[model samples]
Target: MLGKLFLLSLVCFFSLNFLSTINAETNLIADEIQSLKVTNKDPRMINFSVSLTEDHNYTSARLFYFLPNPSLNKSATRGDLNGIQSKFNNFYVDFDTNKGITGSRFIPTGVTFEYYWEFTDVNKNNYKTEMQQYLFLDGQYEWKLLTADNIFFYYYGNYNKNIQNCFLESVSVVKDGSDLLAIKVSYPINIIYYLSPSDSRYAKPTRSIVMDSMTVLGGVKYTSNVVHSYDQDCGVVKHEVTHILNEIAGHGTLLKLPFWVDEGFATYMMNKSDYYDNIIEKMINKNTVIRLSSMQGKPGTPEKVNLYYAQSYATTKYMIEQYGLEKYRSFFKILKEDFVIDEALQTVYGHDQDSLYLEWRQHKGLPIIKLVKIEQSSIPIPVATITPLNFPSKTTVNQQEVENNFSKQNNSNELAVSNFEIFINNYIFIIVGAILLLIMIKISIFLWKK
Candidate 1:
């Protein structure tokens, strides 16, 4: 009976050990299944799902996932079967992941899933935005598997989300002859297109354009029709850009350049053609005849607006052509310092305001005047003559005086007749005869010893 009891005890011990082994195996399988994990990365906090497919031979696993919006996020979500199903149906992801299950034939070779979530607020009211993410698998004793396919799939989702959020407010395709063009501006700054008709004369506000139709001042991207019949040259846009930059760089604070100078600079930057060159030449020619001082600050008359624009453009062009950009820039700089426009020109060009006009006039072959003066106070007066002792006395009547007088008269007659040619010339005979008579009188008195 004791031997029988020992054999039964040995059988009981073996059965208990078998049961314990089976329980341990089951627990190990459970632990391996629990080790599988999935992750999603997105800029926007969106819900998504990931599914795993296993191979019976433990060779590889398939991951199926879906991304409804790939533009904003870069990740996938994993949860209970029902939650995963809900997200998967809404958002779709491509197969990515290749890992084999351990000890068991089941492996997650790929994932299939979906997501539903909102993206972060990208400040794209006036501009567009873009986004990306990474994913790693936490498996039991699987060396922490990571695959690019999975990560890339999430990136695609983020990309798609951004694409969906991106929307163009207005688009314009302008045709100029053989050229095809398109211009688009996004939301927020929609005022660019809604400029008042009056403003159109001055500037083009930020707005939308279509083919012959325009929607200005709308909250959404304002659009307008392309009016080819009324289309202006692209230079018009340049003019508008200048105004925008001027305002944005610090509006009224810019140096108060004269209207002509300001407008001329804008025109130069906008229109650079032979036509403009001709206009400048005309202005230069006109300026040579007219003083710049006379032109400065002169308001345009009703009929002279076109003339004013042309002349202003010419003057500014001349300045830029003669004085390089450095000096041109300096001109504006000085103007900014609150110098009067004329004063600024004088300071930079090394001439007074009026002188510049004169120089320009001269350069253009215009008439100029010069004056001369004579001084009369620099002449000297003649001196009086001295009388000699032997000179003849006209009132003397003595025999010696008479004889001297008679001899003087005869000598004077002889001396006067000496130059007969002088007598022949009427004027010369009068001058010579008088000189000879005075000499004869002196000689006669000396001969008489008086």
Candidate 2:
């Protein structure tokens, strides 16, 4: 009897200790933090206000961020979780000076950010806010913000006569596309652009990292730089603005997309059907055309990328012309609604993707793709897993209940992504960006020395 009683007491002790640890968030520690708030004051400054319990013991604070790509993984590029001392000032700690945090790399315009803050106390306890997001833009520069019924445009710079006289050029092209397709350009479209060689306040990484200027692609990031390409200036601008509309249609920038349809449709709308048409016949003849799915999650080399883009343009143009734009637009929306490519094709074209591919090949007078296996390059994409939960015996489980939960529980939200996994995807882009910036910085240093 005494042995059993002693064992019961031992178990009770450990259980109580475990419960204490689990319930600590609500514990009445006098040093507990009371309130935390943050706001983006401007392009260069962020304001924060924090309050703590009467017996607070403050330690330090830090921030982590990334450049917001306009693609599905909006801010895939990660940067240092740089720190800023909170040096107490009355009731708040505001980072508003040049000494705080300011630079083109850290605060580029038109790029969005995914960021979070962490605060640690003297007790070694860490407190953090849920990750928040924002897009940085050149709000300071606004020469004209125009609205043409539903289409819009924002331009800044001295090229008012050169760039703004035909501000409605892209609007006109898309309007033609709308009339042909029997679809509307969802209201309040922002066709933001500037025609200047010295337009520096653009999106990051690609903002300054212009590639092979001999063949300079005419877009600052996602918005076109009109001064670069006079011949196809409107085409470039229309292509990019169409991308913005597509992003909205795809239910924002975070959702995964089939890039073929996305870019292809954009190219068609921009009237760039023959962007890279010269390579298509040769590719089809040599059986080197990339499969449609290859465009997802990974980008290719510059040459190969152009080929893919051309193929995308060709396919989308064919669909729109042959099957009527109304059906094509419905098809695009279904794909946007998260339907698999195969299912989307089947629903729209009365056949699977493979059948659709064959039909497209037939239209092009090329042989049908047979049993050739396309090898997929492995990428470190995280997939969600679930562990079966065990509840108390009193809880009831049923067939329908179990079936409903299988999907929700194993979705991407619950993936086991480590810090390193998140960092790697962002780090590669950062390295490229850093290399470009460093090259310019080195040249500047050399000039200064001279």
lDDT of 2 by residue, 34-114 (tens): 655555544345554555554545576555544443333333355434344545411343432122212212333344456
TM-score for all models, in order of appearance: 0.31, 0.51
Candidate 2: Cα lDDT at 95: 35
| Residue 275 C-alpha lDDT in model 2 | 40
Error of 1 at 197 (Å): 6.6
lDDT of 2 at 228: 16
What is the lDDT of every predicted structure here? 0.31, 0.48
Q: Candidate 2: which pairs clash? A: 69-74, 77-426, 78-426
Give the TM-score (vs. native) of candidate 2.
0.51
Worst 10 residues of 1 by lDDT: 397-406
- Which portions of model 2 show Cα errors greater than 4 Å? 1-143, 150-152, 159-162, 173-187, 196-198, 201-203, 206-217, 220-232, 250-255, 274-288, 373-450
Q: Could you give candidate 1's per-residue lDDT for residues 140-219 as a string of tens digits?
A: 11222112211111111122332221111011111110011111221111112211233222121221122103112111
Q: What does the lDDT come to for candidate 2?
A: 0.48
RMSD of 2: 19.9
Determine the backbone clash count of candidate 1: 63
